[model samples]
Target: SQGEGPDPYDEILQAFKIMDTEENGFLTLADLKQICESVNLNFSNKIIQEMIEEADNTGDGKISLTEFTSIMCQTGRFKYCAPK
Candidate 1:
């Protein structure tokens, strides 16, 4: 199953809240690296670069909240589950 029943937008927003420490609408490569580190997810620089390029829709060096959320869902890293 995909997981919980919360609205996808809400899920995305929650992800954004977690990633966007600066409260800015965009995330830098450093931000992505930090997230990877926090999750103990070992990722190569090439993979990170590809993720940024694939996820950063605006063509800017940073990724927007929406973009980040979409990537997370697509990657199965974030699953919406019921509260335990």
Candidate 2:
């Protein structure tokens, strides 16, 4: 179900757009928290920190769309959520 959708790319892009606070093609820890909150998902600050460290390839304290998508695809959630 990795790519099962009318527009998986659009869905991914929209997720990134929502998470990118500065609109500079990167998502910060705050952006991650905000995105989770918007979906009513509660994640600890510790977990968020770990995710950021693990996914933020550039070590810039921000994650890019490519990195986020890679993580989501691995988690198997991208298949179900529609573009917001």
Candidate 3:
């Protein structure tokens, strides 16, 4: 049963992989913008700024998987972008 189930983390990892083009385990602001656009979740500047402040745990301008997951989960619901 375990192997038959679709991986829950797959959705989250797929979303991250979409944005992390460089495969550097981090995402730039532009990558974030692209993701938001894909999901039709246009965030206000205030919200985006708040996300960086709250989720950028490492103090790097780039967002790591942990930070991204925390932010995504905090958004009321997880929004997986439809693959293009």
Instruction: Report the C-alpha displacement of residue 54, candidate 3, in angstroms.
Output: 2.7
Tens digits of per-residue lDDT, candidate 2, 31-59, equal: 88888888898999888889899998878
lDDT of 2 at 51: 85
TM-score of 1: 0.65
Root-mean-square deviation of every model? 6.0, 5.8, 6.5
lDDT tens digits, residues 1-84, model 1?
256566656766877777776777787777777889899997887788888899888898788876776677776645543333
lDDT of 2 at 3: 56
User: In candidate 2, which residue ranges exceed 4 Å CA deviation?
Assistant: 1-5, 77-84
Residue 66 displacement (Å), model 3: 1.2
lDDT of each: 0.74, 0.80, 0.74
The full ranking of all candidates by TM-score, starting with the best, is 2, 1, 3
Q: How does residue 46 of candidate 2 score in lDDT? A: 85
Best by TM-score: 2
Per-residue lDDT of candidate 3, residues 4-81 (tens digit): 566655767888898887788988766767678788999875676666677789888778988888777766454443
TM-score of each: 0.65, 0.68, 0.63
Clash tally, candidates in order: 1, 0, 0
Pairs clashing in candidate 3?
none
